[model samples]
Target: MKKSIFLLALVIVFSSCNNTQKIAEITPNEIPSGNYEIKSIQGEPVYKLSFDVDTSENKISGKTNCNSYSGTFSLTNNKIEIGPLSATEMYCEENVMKVEHSLFEAFSNAKTFVYDNNMFVLSSETGIVLRAFRIVKK
Candidate 1:
């Protein structure tokens, strides 16, 4: 009985550790420069959306599940702004256009960024977070 209880306790500890990780809030200087594919927005999954951010040049470019887009971004302290965005004129489905519009709007609202273990998060002042994973360049 004692051995079983000890084993149970050990299992619980490891399981909890795996589920809860220590996330480090990062500054603009600490933000890694790379292409990121969006996994979710505000905890809802987003498919076929990705972007590349160049911290050195303050440039951003990406696809919106339809047309290609390019923009300038500025990161100061904890605040981020992505605006003056330009995209190809290719017409996509109305549903896709709506989603793309919301995403760019979210970028304009981004306030803080954090590195959550395996994910990168850009959050807004109003509590919206865009979670993405790094895209390994070949």
Candidate 2:
């Protein structure tokens, strides 16, 4: 009877450790803790696209192809909302303006986020709109 109890205790301890490991696996995929640069928009790479988020302050700022912008962001669980961004009025070529507009639309419509490895993807209900890669700041 004592041997059976010992075996049961060992099994319980191992199971607990296994559960903890599973939780740890998920922790890395959470909202990343540093700056990230916008790598793509709607599956197309855009020039000079950058993004930064401060999870601690629930704020986000970025530069599009033509202008710099800043805005507030909210995150609940995995859902994300960024909006009401105000940007500089400096004008640019028509193509650059178009890309900037697309970037703003993506951010305004963002509904959720996915983080894997060093990549962060922002998606709307329709589909992914932005993909960003983490930047390790020195």
Candidate 3:
């Protein structure tokens, strides 16, 4: 009888351990997965920049004024790593070219992300490089 009781207790303990591990595997800091409109770049307000994030697939696709770009992204807690992005090659005005270059550089240097009050901010080691607002679809 004592041996049977010990075995049952051991099984319960193992089950509990497994449950705790499963909970730990669940990430508490989930990526904000949705469409967002770019609000600013390098602290300056901007327009016409937007992106969509799919956390389930770790993908990011966006429009950069004159061109559309798609890329893979990975998030580890608050840290974000945007993979090499591919964009359509199209001729554009000088100003638009600058904006596109800045956008791509920002993604390359992005190190951290912050989402608060429906606003999303992407930052590098130096400081914030991009700020976006979550776009809610009707």
The best candidate by TM-score is: 3
Identify the leading candidate in terms of lDDT.
3
- Ordered by lDDT, highest first, the candidates read 3, 2, 1
lDDT of 1 by residue, 20-106 (tens): 657555543456678888988766788889898887888888988788888898777666777789988788899898778777777
lDDT string, candidate 3, 5-120, tens digits: 99999999998887643322324355567899988888878887889999889999998878999999988888989979999999799999898888888888999988776688
Q: How many backbone clashes does candidate 1 have?
A: 0
Query: Lowest lDDT 10-mer window, candidate 3?
Result: 20-29
**Local accuracy of candidate 2 as per-residue lDDT tens digits, 1-138:** 999999999999998887643323445326755678888888789655678878777778877667889888877778888878989988999989888888889999999988887789999999999998888655
Candidate 1: Cα lDDT at 45: 85
Number of the candidate with higher TM-score, 1 or 3? 3
Q: Which of 2 and 3 is ahead in lDDT?
A: 3
Error (Å) of candidate 2 at residue 102 is 0.5
Task: Mark the regions of model 3 whose C-alpha exceeds 4 Å error after superposition.
Answer: 1-28
